[model samples]
Target: MTKFVVVEGRTLKQAMKIISAIVERYNTIPILSHAKITHRAEGLRITGTDLDIEAHIDLDVVDGGGGDWSVCIGVQALAGIARAAGVMDVRIERADNAMEARISVGDGAAFYELQILPEDDFPEIGGKQGDLIEMFTNGMLTATLDKVSGSISTEETRYYLNGVCWHITKQDRRFVATDGHRLSLCTYTPEGGEPASRIIPRKTVKIISNHLANQNLKIYDVDTGKLDIVAPGITIRTKLIDGTYPDYSRVLPSRHDFTLDLKRDEIIAAIDQATATGGQRGAAIKFSNQNGRAVIERRSGDFGNAKVKTSTPWPAGKVEPQPFAFNSRYLRDVAAGCQGAIEMRMTEPGAPFSIFDEDKTMTRVLMPMRA
Candidate 1:
């Protein structure tokens, strides 16, 4: 029989961090990436895995037993317990070749001998860290990535477009992400670290977003190409996806000749009204240049159709009436992102168009569908 003792609070946090990293990417198999807990004189070591994603946590709490014993437990249940448990002592024991956790939190005590899977079944994910750059802030990287990742494709077929693309300029410090539908690019100048670019997988981005929680983080070198993100008491190292992103500069309009300045709310209201008339699900927006005013029309198969005219229309120019139909949802997404006036640029009816703020700091592009 093997027994181990450790502080429940800090150890719980560390274990949860490792478990969460695997669980977020966990699949149908419960035992696939379950954590293995081992107790010795030093402390507790928790290991978790999901084939491609693997994590381990080492706790520094006092260890009572000089002997060693390893037991596998359900990480999901363990996480639930840790979230509710408080500062106390955790006594891990083995009885009848089974593992149990005798947990004490505050004035309450609970004993649970959870059925576990074989530790050998857990797959190992080879994680290597390359040259690492130190990140001192939290919200800056997390928030910027969050904004850009919004446009990432959820489709599995297009594997490359599924995550945020990290681009390091040869001279400037800028990061860019695009999903072929919408794009977000931002720049940051740091005092230190060499310029590097790598595509961060969607799962890793999500894990970082959930854990950062408005706290600062540290980036440490793991091996050669992989980096470990250390935040508070949690540490996660992820392998970067490799691919070549498309040239985004070509999509942007060199000269957006026609411009319309209208209240963000007003355009959103127009979209809503048009969408409602299209049907319950949604519809498309057809922009027609009728003389000076830009006529907006909505079409629906189940229901009927509706058209709404904008008050402050496009300025009179030599450009003739250009008609383009875009998914209503795509238009609304960009409109909701911007405040004040909405700027639209168009070169062709089916060609992609861009809607963004005047500052040009944050831009969203949408491709028009044939109506």
Candidate 2:
């Protein structure tokens, strides 16, 4: 029996783009590089997973003559074929032996054979989704993640800190990320009451951020130790990191004795000029308050040195210049996302300070380095 499925080239191309996020480019397990295609009475569903994260997309098939049989096909191969197939429709047919499949592009003008893996070999991560947790628009989730993603830790040792912590407070729901030296917090109202906090891994955060753009999303069944996100024509399932997040509240400073307001563009340009000097790893940039004006300086023995000053008002009652130092790169990261006026609050040269927007809805905490 020859099993087959026919999908439009354009539709298959879009589905492949979403699946590519979960498909591993290099894998020891061959099945990890392939996408599972299942034909149903209603439509055709395509799924891809790397064991940690899985993505699914459902599309209406042009032809349903292909009997229902789940088969694995190389994601990259199919995507490449679709891209080159121009704007023509596509047809795929399974071999009688179930070992290979044929892809026909543009009324059989081009044809290629793709090797297949048994559907039974693909690991299944599906389960009965639990109770409804919370629902929010995709814009809200993307905005919150954008504010904190820069602070997510990339170090593998501290696996617990490598993702955003999603939790609910008495006031609102919050998304927080930190890498020990810096932290970011973003809050928004929740659709329902508080639910159990889950640490969404960094990779999943990125995938969700990409897919949720301009789409509405719902999060449910969090109690099952997995995060389920459903959007139009898309479903994502990812396992939550099993660990406790640190006490982030304690890290926020209670008092800031000195405050300076500066234009976001001016400050970013100064840092860019300083970083252009190319100093040692984690080089320091000196920020000194001199007579109500802010001075930025960077000294690199290997590359060179640069200094720029901006007219930023200093806190009152301070006669002597107060100087502080911070990692040049970290300061740049915080400044890149900010707009309009940015407020800097600090206590001393050694204390951690905060950089935030005028509204204070989003803030970043950075630890200073010795000059």
Candidate 3:
């Protein structure tokens, strides 16, 4: 290892980028768990990759040599120093089997030593091609992802819906996901971009939503059947799903003979009551429109049951009481944003039903079980 000049003034922002990039690939390989620092004439290139996803940043050094040198350090310590250390000087040194980083901020200075791994073991993730689409920064990207992300399936069997499906039509780019029980779909038009269809894996979409939420970023479609999301100094290449997604639009209820209009929270609380007595499977909720008030009742085989009577602002057509059983867990997922007002449309007790929020931008369809 060769000796190098220390950094006198490096912003917290630059240190954060280097730490994030290193940690991102730490778990990919044993060597990746260690940070690699290289010095060149241009600057210092801090890079990390797990062979699947990669992140790198080039920071200007105060004074450095022309030859490249590799020294591995613990990822956790680097991240901690980057977060805790304020503005000051940093002295990095390479020893026999370890690397030490001395961070100085204000009048306090702390030194940490981390075990080293061979630089050759660090993996590099090669870029691949998929489809790319550009989206403007605003509420459209974040809102769409937040509204639909929860509905993605955690089950490994139904692999198709495990991630959000990027369905692009001529007019709009849509995202759809389902867990075999309920489905959620959100759509937005690209401010200025091409239209293409792809399936973005679950984890990739989540990381992107967190980093790029409400921030403008370029979405690159790789030809290798992967989605490349670039936000600021972060880039995420998520593998695309090759399986066919279910025809979700067809699952939506077309027409309903009965519509129950009530507040989202009101119905959610009623469902919670039913869950307490009904066991994990869920209790039965009976809907009846008598006079003007809509009556909802729940009965539990084990625990005691309760009834919730709530009035609707809209007119309720005369209909017989419908006895239906639904998994309360499913109801909660659909009613998450139903704070203001919600509408439920159904044709029969055992038929599929649709629930809508106030804006109607999103709708959840729940299949009913026979009582």
Cα lDDT of model 1 by residue, 19-100, tens digit: 7666644568867636777776656777776654455676776445647766777777777667766566555554444444
Model 1 pairs whose backbones collide: 128-226, 129-223, 129-224, 129-225, 129-226, 130-224, 130-225, 130-226
**Model 2 clashing-pair count:** 0
**Which residue runs of candidate 3 sit more than 4 Å off their true CA positions?**
1-29, 32-52, 57-72, 86-108, 128-132, 190-195, 276-292, 313-321
The number of residue pairs in model 3 that clash at the backbone is 9
Candidate 3 structure quality by residue, lDDT tens digits, 1-371: 35453554445345444446535543635675665666667666566544445555556666554366766666666666665654565555555434444334434466655566676666666666455466557635666777788889999988877788878876667778788777777665533235456777776667556555776666777766666666554455656777888878888878878776777777777767656554646544665455667666666666666676766533445755355656667776677755477777788666678877765556677777544
Ranking by TM-score: 2, 1, 3
Per-residue lDDT value at 202 in model 2: 95
Best by TM-score: 2
Cα RMSD of predicted structure 3: 4.2
Which candidate do you rate higher for lDDT, 1 or 2? Answer: 2
